[model samples]
Target: MRLDKFLKVSRIIKRRTLAKEVADQGRILINGDQAKASSNVKIGDTLTIRFGQKLVTARVNDLKETTKKEDASELYEIIKEERIEDSHLL
Candidate 1:
């Protein structure tokens, strides 16, 4: 599955266009490497996403073209989520 589609299907980003825009801005990484919106996402791949001050890392657990809301959370397992502290604020 494409990264953008996977994000939306998994309900991680809420929208495919938003995922694409985030990926294009270099705010997403796959397996520790920067990824594009069209990047291929496979089962077991680790994804790290930056959302403003938060960083979320998840491992892909499943893939589907479409999933119900109840099933979306099963697509990935969150490995870590942390708030990025701005050093400038210190």
Candidate 2:
């Protein structure tokens, strides 16, 4: 699955376009390497996403073209989450 699609299908980003935009801006990493919107994603791959002050890392647990809301959470397992303080704020 594509990174963007996987994000949406997994209910991580909420929208595919937003996922694409974030990926294009270099805010997403797969297996510790920067990834593009069209990057291929596979089961067990680790994804790190930057959302402003928060960083979330999740491991892909499953892949599906589409999933119900209740099943979305089963797609990825959150490994870690942290809030990063901006240096400019100091």
Candidate 3:
């Protein structure tokens, strides 16, 4: 599935458009490489997302075209969350 769609479907981001915007700005990485909104996301792939001063890392667990809100968390497993100083964002 698409990165943006996966983010939305998994509830990692509430909106697909916002996810795309974030991905486009180079704030997201897949397997340690910068990824775009249209990037393909497969099972077991690792995603590192930047949200302001925080960075969240998750491992893709499954893929679905659509999922119930309650089941969204099944799509990915959060592996780590860390806060970074502003300068590290560079």
Candidate 4:
């Protein structure tokens, strides 16, 4: 599955376009490297998404084209979440 679509299908980002934009702007990384919206997603891959002042890390647990809302969380496991201090660049 695509990175952007996976994010949306997994209910992480909520929208595919937003996910694409985020990925394009380098706010999303896979396996510690910046990834594009078209990047392939598979099991066991770690993803880090930066949302404003927060960062969310998750490891892919499974791959699916579609899933129910109740089962969306099964797609990935949250590894860590933390706040990013000092939004203004030096």
Candidate 5:
């Protein structure tokens, strides 16, 4: 699955366009390397996303074309989530 599509299908970003934009801005990483919107996402791959002040890391668990809202989280397992302190941006 494409990174942008996976993000939306998994309900991580809420929209495909937003996910694409975020990925294009170099705010997403796959396996510790920068990822593009068209990057391939496979099961067991690690993904790190930068959302404003928060950094979220998750491991892809499954891939689905579509999923129910209640089961969206089944797509990935959250490994860590941390906030970026102001000093880190300096």
Candidate 6:
């Protein structure tokens, strides 16, 4: 599955277009390297998304064409989520 699609299907970004835009802007990464929206997503892959001063990291657990809202949780497992405070940088 494509990274953008995976993000939407997994309910990460909420929309495919937003996911794509985020990826194109280099706000998304895979395995610690920058990744494009069209990048292939497979099980066991690690994804990190930058949201403002925060970062969300997750591991791909499974891939599916379609899934119910209840089943969406099976798509990926959140490994870590941290909010970076700008004050810490000062």
**Using TM-score as the measure, which candidate wins?**
3
TM-score for candidate 5, residues paired by index: 0.93
Task: List model 3 lDDT by residue over 1-90, tens digit each.
Answer: 999999999999999999999999999999999999999999999999999989999999999999999999999999999998884662
Candidate scoring better on lDDT of 5 and 6: 5
**On a 0 to 1 TM-score scale, where does candidate 1 land against the true structure?**
0.94
**TM-scores of all predicted structures:** 0.94, 0.94, 0.96, 0.94, 0.93, 0.91
Runs of candidate 4 with Cα error greater than 4 angstroms are: 88-90
lDDT of 4 at 76: 97
Q: Please, what are the lDDT tens digits per residue for candidate 2 over residues 58-86?
A: 99999999999999999999999989897
Report, for all candidates in order, the number of backbone clashes: 0, 0, 0, 0, 0, 0
How well does model 2 score by local distance difference test? 0.92
Greater TM-score among 3 and 5 belongs to: 3
Residue-level lDDT of model 6, residues 8-39, one tens digit each, is 99999899999999999898889988899999
Q: What is the C-alpha lDDT of each candidate?
A: 0.94, 0.92, 0.96, 0.92, 0.94, 0.90
**lDDT tens digits by residue: candidate 5, 1-90:** 999999999999999999999999899999998899999999999999988899999999999999999999999999999899762441
Clashes of 4: 0
Model 1 score (lDDT): 0.94
Instruction: State the local distance difference test value for candidate 3.
Output: 0.96
Evaluate model 4: give its TM-score.
Answer: 0.94
